[model samples]
Target: MAEPRPRVWVSQPLIDAVIEPLRAQVELITTDEVTAWTAEQLAARLADVDGAIITLNERVGAAQVAGATRLQVIANVGVGYNNLDVEALSAAGIVASNTPDVLTETTADLGFALLMAAARRITESERWLREGQWGQWSFQTMLGADIHGSTLGILGMGRIGQGIARRGAHGFGMRVLYHNRSRLPEAAEGEVGAQYADFDTLLAQSDHLVLVLPYTASSHHIIDAAALAKMKPTATLVNIARGGIVDELALADALATGRLAAAGLDVYEGEPAVRPELLALHNIVLTPHIGSASLATRKAMVQLAADNLLAALNVDGAAARMPSAINAEAAFAARTASGDKSKKR
Candidate 1:
């Protein structure tokens, strides 16, 4: 009997180009319709699969990982891997990878676009015009804030944050202030023309504050009621990061009472369905999480993720095994030496 080819499952329908490269290498299973799958459904499909390519839609926590004992790798299609319990995957000896770097500039561009849209009430003004509400050219009919010469505050100073800061400083002549886990070196700061500020100072001084931090347990709802209270009443809030980073209810309250001037949200606490309160307000702008939605960028991201999947599954002769496996023996050794302290984090 011949050895069976590895079975691969793609959780969602991806661009044809992404899958075309994998077709000849494995027994591929994929869906044309993109929909959220239940845990049971995921478990059912995971059975007998050696590798899987998934998106942020499915929650691949401990249960799903444990059920797919034969599974060796999970190639996540997005930069954010919050949907996957990485610690659980690591413990299960499953290699998990994501598409990063490639989407950084594109996502940052969207973040800046959202900031400009929110500051100028772009969507609201368009709606008003479409409704034939522009009966007269009144001066104060749809007044909005100015972006240039304003203070742009950023929550996360990662690569994407630096990109936004560069755009603001160079393109818009905006003063940029950022709060990060650690300050960037002086040369890097000079390049972006950004100044490091404390969390409270960043919140209080910014004309437009944007969140681009990752989602972790410690970072959950980092922008809650107290954080909102710290910001300027006339400040605008823009979130292009993970949904759980901001408190939706508190944000709605802040926007409702004019505690904050306006908001531009690309990601919501519970996505696909935004809060009713936010929907009713005219001061906020909502998008369906399309930060990396440009045609070229989307294609590149999908291709990179497909490459990662193929590499992790060792499908192509040119592909390497999952990078995580290189350190797996070290992990096991450290676990034995440290009495299983390897999983503590």
Candidate 2:
């Protein structure tokens, strides 16, 4: 008799092209629904599966991992794996992976688009015109900030950040200043025509400041009232990064009182439910988190994640694993240390 094929579960619907290869190799269980699962539902479904392809909506934390004793790998469809309790999964000896480089340029494009929309009041002006407010064109009817010859500040200098800088420096003829944990090498800096700026300096000097940082414990709410107060009052703020980096309530208040000129947001702290105040304001540009929503890019992301899943599950003829596996051993160690700290406290 032949050996049983490894069982794979897809938590959400993915492009058929991306999953067809996997289906051929495994006993596939899939769902067309995009809804999130309850803890009990996730636990029950994972009980017998050997691996899973999950998206950002599902939380694959300690509880789910504990229930899925046979599970060995999880491939996240998105670049950000914050929804996964990585440390817990690592400790359970379960390999976890995400799609990264594939979506960098596409996400950067959305970031720059949002920056332009916010600066030029694109969405707001369009809404006003649609509401029958455009009787006639008047001088300074809908004046907005310029992109060329302006300083663009970036909060994070990751791959996506670098992509945005390239567009600003080469395409728009804008000065770029970036603040990150570490500065890029001189060669890279010269290539992108970007300069390193301290956080406060970047906040103060930039005509338009964009956040492209990740969400980590250290980076949570990096932009609060104090940080916002340091920014130029006339400057526009754009967040294409994770929503936790900014205090949305504070941002709404600032925009309402003209403490800041205008704002744009792609991600929210508690997503799928935006603050009512932000929706009411005309000085802000809001979008559902579609930073990497391009058809080509989304397809690439799904394929990349599928590849990672196949390799981790040791499927024959699958793509190679990502060079960086997030260092599972290190993650376990960090979690142990955190638990010890908590116990002592």
Model 1, 277-317: lDDT tens per residue?
88999989999998888878777877776666667556644
Which one is best on lDDT?
A: 2
- Give the local distance difference test score of model 2: 0.85
**Best-fitting candidate, scored by TM-score:** 2
For all predictions, the C-alpha RMSD in Å is 4.0, 5.0
Q: Which stretches of candidate 1 lie over 4 Å from their true place?
A: 316-345
Alpha carbon lDDT of each predicted model: 0.83, 0.85
Tens-digit lDDT track for model 2 on 1-345? 865778999998888878877777899999987867998888888888878888888887899877666776788889899988887887766778888888999999999998999999999899989999898779989888998889999999999999999999999999999999999999999988899999999999999999999899889999998889988888899999899999998899889988898899999999988999899999999999999999899898888777666676666635465533554455335446546311110
lDDT of 2 at 47: 82
Cα distance off (Å), candidate 1, residue 155 = 0.4
Candidate 2 Cα deviation (angstroms), residue 313: 1.1
